[model samples]
Target chain A: MGRRVKVLLIGFGSVGRALAKVIALKRKIINSRYGILIDVVGVADSKGMALKAEGFDEYELLKLCEVPRSGVNLFKPYAHQGVDLNILYSNTQPDVHVELTPSEYTSGEPGLSNIMYAIDRGAHVVTANKAPLVLKYKEIVSRALSRGVRIKFRATVLGGTPFISTLTSMRSHDVERIEGILNATSNFILTEMHEKLVEFTDALKMAQALGIAEADPTLDIDGVDAAAKIVIISNILERPLKIEEINRESISRVSLRDIIDAVRQGYVIKSIASFDVRGGKASIRIAKIPRSELFAQINGVMNGVRIRSDATEVVFIGRGGGGIETAHSVLDDIVSLSFEDS
Target chain B: MLGRRLCVVKIGGSLLRDSKSYIESAQKIREVFVENGYKAIIVVSAAKGVTDKLVQVAKGSQEALRHIVEKYLEVAKELNSVKVIKRVNEELKRLEIVAGAINRSGVDLSLYDFLLSFGERISKILLVGALEATGVNALELHADELIVTNETFSDASIDYISTSANLEKLYSSIVDSPTIPVIEGFIGSTIDGRITTLGRGGSDYTATAIASLLNIDRVYLVTDVDGIMTADPDIVENAKLVRTMSYRESLEASLHGAKRINPKAFEPLEKFYSSKLIIGSWSKFGTEIVKEIPRELWGPKVIMNRASQDMSYMAIVGEGTSSVQFIRNVLEIIDRNGIEILGLQSYVHRPSLLVYVSSTYELKTLHLLHKELFEGV
Candidate 1:
């Protein structure tokens, strides 16, 4: 409550909305309970940036989102709409920057561009966009560390659930194996198909109907999204996993008959993003787990992670992808960054 | 309650309503317990109101049947525990057939009991699954298996000998196995394998019965309220919490309609059991009702009152209540104020007395008694 920490957010998308929701809901929780207040001082989209040096009002931001073609160009008073990133960063020195832009694999430019700018300004970075971490983990981490600022992307792996922190904490122990249902869209489709004995297309339709799967859902169904998360994990664990190195298998190959067969066999097929760090080399793949496997039981849009560590084998289950859930994660990073507890 | 070294936490339906809260509470519980070197075995109820709604379906409310099924399915979808949802749906289908037979053949109480037990059974299974899912090595023990009861229809009496034997057989290794064993409260069974419920607010009884039978340390009945207040909070605006009370006081207060402790919950911990029972909320700082008085306490025999729409009762419970002078002193104070007491009862077995009066005189009576008890000139 003493000092209000400023936050710079890039890419005002679904995840951006979620993070903002957490700040609004947890504003009282943070102030009364944790004695910290975080302000999203700056927010930018693909078009331009908005700057409010004092604080970017959450209500205004949410209203701006509701308006058509008006992400960074909402209000005129305190909010300087349509200002570019260079002008926004230099003018309003933020404490933390949140990168949540659209993910691009070959070139993580949009996310990397904001990340570099934020780090150069001695501001911390919290992002959910996977392209930045998957493409340039070492460079970003080193830059943030050299500047004595933190870089957290809990949303990138398992939105707002602390999977990355949990993994990093268990680094003291020998983590022999790691497995999870990281992609919620694939899991939702598979669970629907298996439970109803419906065809893959019907299940995908159901997922789309329920807003669980995206319209295209190619990255999720094709295992690209989960593979990207595995790569992030590999980089965090110091295993250095490349996107090309993973033996990726898409859930689309699973036919209606395959789903029925698995159900009859007392097994549920989940898109498992896994890594075995014990061996000299690590591998990432989407493999079928028996009914007894913990990952098999995780269904719908829920995401679960099981880390077979030296001390214990623990499971972390949560809403894998939701505007609200992931937003809470981004808010969590901001809170930890501002509060003394984390 | 494990021992002097443990804390028995009963997580009721209010807390375990969703996966996020479950995981959050689990993490917080583990953090606090692990830090203090205390082991905890949490007894979880069904996610808020799922049990009652399930019962409506079983009792042949056709209109409520589909709604009940959808609720469980929704929770299963939310918790990602569809195995439970599938099993519950199958059981519900079977229940529909049984209910039809029951409707034709006159309502069988035993069948009704079996039908009601499904809620707790499903809840226990899902909660344990969820706890395990959240990385808390938790196992589910059926209340029927752990809590043997008589063949009473709605309210069943616990058969301790058989129940203890069953619990020992099923969960002896779990004491130190570092795995939390979750059991359904309020539902148990007879020797003949007939399902029976422990009755209203029976989950607390189930938790205490297990704690006493297992001889674990403390039984924490975590409810929605902070603790037993000096008066019913809704009626008395200035009701403050009585931080520490004896089991005798809690029993008296509960008898007088204080919702903190279940009256039946105290029967199991009556004897030489050292396990203390603490009544607190999910947040913290409630009342601690112990089996015996610890030496360090310094407090008067607090007057705890509860007032409903028509009735009000004040309970004065303490070891000092045995003396005739104390009783007279309390009576004379109420009498001097010209307050008409409807009922006054004292027990020789316990150190407590209850005074039930009309709700109209509650405020005036409390003012006179407060001056007499604490602010004596």
Candidate 2:
């Protein structure tokens, strides 16, 4: 039998659900392969929370996924509705607190508070929300360190592609720069404009229609999403920078004519987010990279990050927007945390 | 189960475009049914452009496949519910498997229909999520589990007997529960368990079929447009909303490209029960399609226009328009004006007549028909 790790998931949104589903669907394989049996003891959403002292079974986890607002209904045998996170933590006493709340960059509330509270209570924290880290990375990390609790946020940047993890593992090598297409939505819209010869607005509409972009796409189109990722990356590289310091340029002004003209000139317009680690600078802008470049080849809702280090320039390309992939990354982080503790 | 007051609401794809609408829909459902002490069954289409993207995925567009998955994820994110988001991911995974099979094996209609079913399947989860977010206890009821059909794949006709039995059983199981059941409209499954779709605009058919089976009094078809209009509002600036019309009138209008209601949607209602069908948007009630129209309200309920590059016509739809006297009078007027009628079609059973003429004469024909059919009334 593998080691048992009890998890309490907050914010039952796409990423959270994806993690639950992944745990349910790949329970046996994950347990056998990683020697860890994850037990989700508590789940909470905006409306209510569900707690089980004995931890939830695979069937319970799946049933939780089918419920409407909260997993509270799934705990009908011992139903407690409208329970807050405080009650959940005290009752369930989870080993790891999984924070999947929506990013609130201004104050990082809910996620920030949730992370701090979990760490204060002596539980490891794994987060997919980037807002808290973007706003107060140092404070959170220092708090986690002081408390001797591991805080893993592998799904925060690049939709859980292990970009940060890879960067962290390469600590021995002095990386000169880090740059690539960080925002999948912006990259997808730019690709659509160039390939379909449509106006920027039309490209955005297509992206929105396809679910590649958010309803309020200002964060992505205006370079804020990528900038946030850059900020996180800068923090990871030990070159912490504020989002306000990044030179940002939105993709909104990249018109159809611009795309067509660029295409004719053997160049492709990519919404590139780059961090010059040595200079301690970050910027997100629409760059006309040559068609032959690897960055230009990365299209649609796929993210690519190129790491230029003293050893080599390595690129990681993967699906950048969907919840399943992100959830998988979160799970990976959870497993890695479990291994570290062991 | 028999005495429970229930109404089926079919929400169109256009309404699922934004997050506000989902909340608004939940609020509306709460107001119209939950608060009023009625059980509501919601039938939803994929968010706008989801089905198209799924179809493209079936055609082996990897981009479309990504889009389909992301669209549901995006909706799940907006709803911000973990259960729904997880369910959406599970459904998308199944859809991706089906898509992968289709891409490898070329085009198979059955597989394609199965692929398309994911749109409504995912939409149902999102809607239920939103409804629950709004404090409504909602459960997703997959139509395939309730509605049984033949193996016709894309446009399968419902096997009414089995479907009615399944629906009744399903209702009986959840009769005591307070939760609202949300269903995918355009998709179903065969008795043998193969996935199927009811074709385009089939969501309307799904609602009507369920209403007929349950013997519900009214089924609301909520769409982006107000309802069946006097004409396509783009062409006729003064086009008014059709407040009430007979099912036959609606059917006729639909056949002539009204597109407000699916032609097949009237079949189950016309045959089995006398359910009142209401079509409208969220803000206003638009049209009521009843089993019968009163004799006093029988003439020119709606004026529908159809135009092509070379040919065009104005269709006058009303119970009175099917009368011999009305058609004769219309022909006489056309003769008196020496207007060329390229083609004309009328049936005694259908309460509408199409007068096709040259494309140039479309507006003139509309004015002439309006003068004769609507001016005095």
Which structure among the candidates has the greatest TM-score?
2
lDDT of candidate 2 over B1-377, digit per residue (tens): 36557888989998887657777878888887789888878999988898888877877899988877776787788887656676677678767666755664444566678788888888877788788788988876768667888888899898889999878755655666678888999988877456799988999999999999899988999888888888767866667788999998898888877877788899999889778998898777789999998898888877867775656777888897878888889999888878888988888877888789887777877877766666554
lDDT of prediction 2: 0.82
lDDT of 2 by residue, A209-257 (tens): 4446766889889988889888888888888999999999989988888
DockQ of 1: 0.01
Instruction: Output the worst ten-in-a-row residue range by lDDT, candidate 1 chain A.
Output: A62-71
Q: How does chain A of every candidate compare to the true chain A by TM-score?
A: 0.92, 0.95
The collision pairs in model 1 are: A18-A327, A19-A327, A160-A329, B1-B8, B1-B217
Share of the reference A-B contacts seen in candidate 1: 0.00
Best by lDDT: 2
Tens digit of per-residue lDDT, candidate 1, span A247-313: 7788888888777777788877777777887762433344667889778888877889888878899
- lDDT at A338 for candidate 1? 75
| DockQ of each two-chain model | 0.01, 0.04
